[model samples]
Target chain A: MAGPSTYVPKSGFERWLDARLPVVRMMHGQFIEFPIPRNLNYMYTFGGILMIMLVSQIITGIVLVMHYTPHADMAFSSVEHIMRDVNYGWLLRYMHAVGASMFFIAVYLHIFRGLYYGSYKEPREVLWILGVVIFLLMMATAFMGYVLVWGQMSFWGATVITNFFSVFPIVGDTLVQWLWGGFAVDNPTLNRFFSLHYLLPFMIFGVVILHVWALHVTGQTNPTGVEVKQKSDTVPFTPYATVKDLFAMVLFLLLFSYFLFFLPNYLGHADNYIEADPLVTPTHIVPEWYFLPFYAILRAVPSALGGVLLMFGSIAVLFFLPWLDTSKVRSGAFRSIWFKAAFWLFAINAVWLGWLGSKPAEGWYVPAMQIGTIYYFAYFLIILPVLGLFETPKPLPNSITESVLKKNGGQIASGAGQPAGATSAPETKG
Target chain B: MAFFSSRSLKSLVIAAAVALVPAGSAFAAGDSKPPRMQDWSFAGVFGTYDRAQLQRGYQVFAENCSACHALSRIAFRNLMEPGGPEFSEAEVRAIAANYFVMDGPDSFGDMFEREARLSDRFPPPFPNQEAAVAAMGAYPPDFSLLAKARAPTRGFPGFVIDIFTQYQENGPDYIYSLLTGYDEEHVNPEGELGHYNPYFMAGEYIAMAPPLFDGMHVYQDGSPETIDQYARDVSAFMMWAAEPHLEQRKEMGFRVMAFLLIFGGLVYMTKRRVWSAVDH
Candidate 1:
């Protein structure tokens, strides 16, 4: 894929179009002939899964908009109408709703895969940063989408999350009013949310194009984390990665259908069934499952502003991940045991944070979130930077081909020209 | 952290699924206890709403609950739908005509009451929420989506299992609990007539007084008409009203899942064939 184009236009029209516009060439080079590390595992399939999810969300969302009422007064009934009256409308709504959750699942897997394999390091930093941007866009989109339902949770979730802005200084209240378009989360808020909820997915679609473009530039990282050294060490994107991704997608759809059909309302709050009423508020105002970890982080601090900052910081810190982790080694498999322990613990602590976030911020739950919050930050700011300075990474293979051969139990790989362990580099930045 | 725990693949899936288990929201508010899990006729992957039971449930709703509650979302025609109560067309027309729905101004600019059409929604007993509140000291919640609107907590590890076990009946379970919860032992009535059931999400008091009782409705189908039976029936009816497509959905879900599983198997085989020459 990195080499000169081997594409040959087949016919007269093809040649003419190829000369006028090189779209076919681009697709051919980017997809058909693209080189991916042969050792790529199930984790590597999530990028494709994410792309499909984005498309699924957009399609389902657009269909929903046709029947969905954006007005606060009618939105709740409109949803019920879709479920009850519209033909196959319930199926579409559930697909879109469950698709959102499934999209997050794929994205989380993709991000964690990147972290585990050090896909964020060096030349891939721009791709990683673009991903973080997409993540932000996704959160905003999901938040707005949830509010458009105009359920009790929708009303209060809009109220509570928007109220987070009021913790700022002199302009706090003003900023909130601007956000709400009124003194409270009312029709105007719902209107704007509906508009943006529709608009943001397209914006996400645009960023995803760039995301893929950037990914192609740096290429994909495999579980081995060794950069592509030769063509023999990798396989063509089609007939290999495509087949693998297709298989994974089918399995993913199976899981998704389970939720979409049998358990449509499982991911949703029951209160959402109740129409939005400004006069009434449910006792618990919890965001969707995706936001729980961040919500916990927000509540970890006693100070409201501090909590908000920390919550935002949890995501913002990810932007600096490439530089924060001083380790020269890529992939946890090759990193020292301490690094492995820290990384997995970091992952588990995050899950714990999500669990804690779901519970009310009372009793020991509050203190547990505080501790989890500290570790969440400590993993990025402290452990990552400090561990890289002292920990020794395991010896790396001479090339991707060599690693593949080693895994196959000492088969001699003629493609691996250089001897293993012959070329050694220091793990530390210094 | 077991970096490569025994059976790493399966464990990893469980760990991730556990992490994402329905966090934050219960059915509704931050109620202290989860509703008792019930074994519903329609509670699993293949579960379908029992047709006969749904009809009986509708009977309970029409007889006891209809005076205060409004199933405004339900049209008379909906009762004739295949998956629902499945009442005949003539029967549904008879049921519709039984109610006097507000009709339109004819040639003159005036409104009049007439027999409800099949298309007409079930009318509310009260003119509006304010009127209902004034009449009853608290506004009666609309029964249309009430079954979907209420869900008690299913705490910790138990809630996690609810996902696989397909326990999506929190709404019906909570409703049944509240209806039967009028037992004096667990009931907490405030002042003269203020009813407060511990099962209520709003904490202060269950604004609606206990509506169900023994022999609430004489069951013509020979089904028991005890307080428990009535509560269960009404709750089930409410669930049907809230999600009329439950049977169709579950049926459709099974077909889709089966197709995907078989297709996935083929794709897996193709993938294996495609990658046979490669050494990943």
Candidate 2:
């Protein structure tokens, strides 16, 4: 399923272990010699950056759970205690809080990159679906983690969002009660949320293993959207992709540190710092920034049930995106001008919806949100599919190497197709 | 041919129009006034709180605001912690000893009030809301997280500019404005008698009256005790209360970012050296 392992054990102890386990050989095959498209751009590095973020969140989260109290009475004060008393506890807490926001930021970019390059197309559907599942798990984990803070927004956000299940008619009210472990969001709810918040991340970790496995099976899709034709079209994973990934990872960490240290609360709502008060509701109830677009969809519809269905439907459509746009061309680069226009319109509409979500539901926001919502659904359900049938894509280069050479002004040796910008140009034989 | 040829241009115009709607609405009248920005000592990426300013702020709170507002999340020892006012251990011990904290149950199995311990949270002035409201005719909010909880929503261009400039002093800015924004000429009946601050978010009035005056609190360290000075100092102290680890956080961030840059450069070099033999 992977490239053939070329590992050779040098010592007798290593050889003996290799014969029994072969794990080292498996690592060598998967990471060392795996073929990657040489045309990959910086956007490809988000996958590695995401991996680092996930591990960082997990480590910081484990330390946080050590001091966090799950009881509603103690939870808010306990968090305060951690900030005031525990050694370096503030760093761990801030990292986990800010890390969730960073994770969503990276994932959104990754998803958009996939959309732009048709990464979800044939032979990669399973890989794409796994990513959607991972995203769903992330949303669930983050929602529960927010509730564990026991702040006003945490308690009420949980109450309001979980109450959405009541739109299900027959089983709705009971389902919400079951989920909350009571009639309302209270002590039991906080405890259960704390439990699930801890459990979901491990499940995400398990699913991530499957996600990477699926990616390796199909190999990575490149920016040019051209498949590797031969040895010349690809580069080995370690030195080529690894170094680039490392460099990108460092850049990502710099941004993360900027938020963690300098503007830690920029992404957070001020209302959340106040302890949860069931009797006195906050003037404005808003979710984290990552959930804003979906929140917009929920409020776009007037009917309660309709709003719930549409909100879930927005994410549900992503599961079917691989089949939704029938375009055969893998890259937006080659798609007709009309299709590209629609693509950007779709992006702008989504962002507009997010802005609307943060605004009050009255005034001009209501009508604007409705229009934005319509465009959002239209772009996926009508525009993409219909455009694919009529749009003419630009002619694809014969190979990735050919595409690379053409982009470089055709300066390289044509027959052998040496990379014109290959490293250490002075060392190349004349 | 015309319809098909102009399709992209048509959509571009529509997109531009749709984008302008929000900006236009943001400028419309009847919207709440935006809070004025203050020159906080802790406003930017590298900005750290001035320990002396924070201590002065703490004095103001202790003398005036602490009568009504509870700093329940703060411990006396926190004043001595890094990135805070950095009071001496002896001073912290003395401060803690001044307050009465409810402790409890000895051989007779009864709750008892005792002197505050270093670990005890700051005691609330009132036992509950009913008593509090009866005493002051309003509920005084807790100061524990008030600095973090109150901030003006910066709209439009200022919001966009705030990102690149790393402007995150909104909470303290709002507090400072509220402290100094009282108008004696105009009174709003919505708030409690003698309390009117237009800078408050809810209405043109607030429950808490202007608590500070020029030279109300004497500064033994020779610093001015003007209303503006007191407001700034108290705001700085609240920022510290909300985020006690600010200095350490910024210091560590600089070191981490520096390391990443050097490491990234080395990795880039290694990538180039290793890919020297590749031919596309």
Candidate 3:
């Protein structure tokens, strides 16, 4: 290890900057000197992409706060004023609105990437857990923010959600009252939602920091199912990972921009323009698109309480994922055929659930939801553990370097005496 | 090995500490009272207003609120009435042009713009009623019935309730109070009312804001620059927008009731003619 040496600065500004930050040195030591696997794919870029989205949300939200009115009556109209009255307000409003959908899109992909790569395994467990926390917070913040608009959908959505507590066994009504701060979802409810919505993003920011910290501790996992060994097996993170992440982020922005400019309200509901009316309910009330899957889960069960529990369980089960898989291998590349097939089945089941959620519950809808709901749980509990014990995995290379060489159709360098078969040994030790 | 172990321990401690602080605070807060609107101006913006602005207000409302709120009562044909304020036939067509309305057995849909024909009520977002309810947990209420059902009262109960609920004003007074009533220090000294919301009319907290910009719409010629003036104008627009046919509905209701009474007497007389042959 190198010891700190006395430094002589030639300029006053250099001394001042060094005294305050030492940012350059820290960046050099942490990123430039850090060793990372060379064979990482685009999937690894999601965390960085998520970070970009987080920053975008914070910036856009702050700008929106400048013009937004948090009162229930004015919220709907104020949003209108933003669209019609503010200079370029329409663009800002559309971007922020669409940006929210884009954020969720990125987060869903990030979470699925973790699942596919087994990025939550062993040392990376905490990182994945923090990511889950971030996910929960994001849901809460988004839901509350929706209520801040005070539109018909906003009002009815709040009423429906707060009323979900009424399904609880004994204290349900009390809980609902507690949530609403009144007999109905009215002014108090709106006020509180605004405050919490304003505060939660900061909490998300903190959790995100923890997420990145945890990632740094465990390091990133690569696609080849081989661990980093020698310095030659890896590359520095700065120019390599940074460039790739930036490229992915730019590509994502292009997609988001297209939606923001061309089809601003394409994903939105038309009824929201009417102000909130507690007495005369709109004929239909659908939640934001991102929540469709879980919304389907809520409707799957016949009983209200049962539906709520199942909906919550769908997300809560993610915390137990590390323990439930029971697989000796971490990466999907090395997983058995049965496990691979099960993963795809689970993905299809989730998509089916989202589709079912959007449809009216009638005839075949309920039964279909029930089946999708069962598969959703079965994938985590039964399939993972059973596949781990019975199925046989394919052979894996000794190190990341060897895996890449094999892919490139090149032999290992001569006289490097490290046995090609030694890869499974360290894994077994783990 | 020592370095790695100590560093890991440090990381664990840091993580534990980070998690603990928030958890502790959250528990201490113990379901901290949900945030209340603190300013009066914000409350006024959210409060329901007069019935006159229904037409022109609907246009502004449609441009902004439709994405999140649903008004089920009003139909496409309603916009064509002379009394309807927001859009002319050409404008309605232009506005509808952007959307595709599903029709016929082919499952093919065409874009709407211009005058809405008889079949052209606002298109339902979902396929049918069942789907909408399934997705949202409840049917979104229609706007046509909204003003009638939830219209503010003017008597003692209304006054007492308004006072207790921290509603500082009512009707036009309420609207005016809300738009201009923002103040951070307007909290009740006795702690009877909650936080003072600047946007609220009655000095109570509200979930809406006063939504007028300094110069949102330029009336055909030239309009003055003032946010307050715009707020009042929009509020007037909202009143009429909510109940476009209030006067007509009241007048028709009375006339129909009178016509029903006379029709009942005539039906009673006709009954004797049919029974004359059977009377023996």
**Candidate whose lDDT is highest:** 1
Kindly give the stretch of ten consecutive residues in candidate 2 chain B with the minimal lDDT sum.
B12-21
- DockQ-based CAPRI category assigned to the predicted complex of candidate 1: acceptable
lDDT of 3 at A141: 93
Show where candidate 2 strays beyond 4 Å: A1-3, A410-430, B1-32, B188-194, B276-280
> Native contacts recovered, in order, as a fraction for each?
0.54, 0.50, 0.00
Q: How far is candidate 2 from the true structure (C-alpha RMSD, Å)?
A: 8.2
| Sort by TM-score, top down from the best | 1, 2, 3
TM-score of each: 0.92, 0.92, 0.60
DockQ of each: 0.29, 0.27, 0.01
Evaluated against the true structure, the overall lDDT of model 3 is 0.61
* Regions of candidate 1 where Cα sits further than 4 Å from its true position: A413-430, B1-34, B105-107, B185-192
The RMSD of every model to the true structure, in order and in angstroms, is 8.9, 8.2, 26.5
Clashes of 3: 74
Q: For model 2, report DockQ.
A: 0.27
Q: List the residue pairs that clash in candidate 1.
A: none
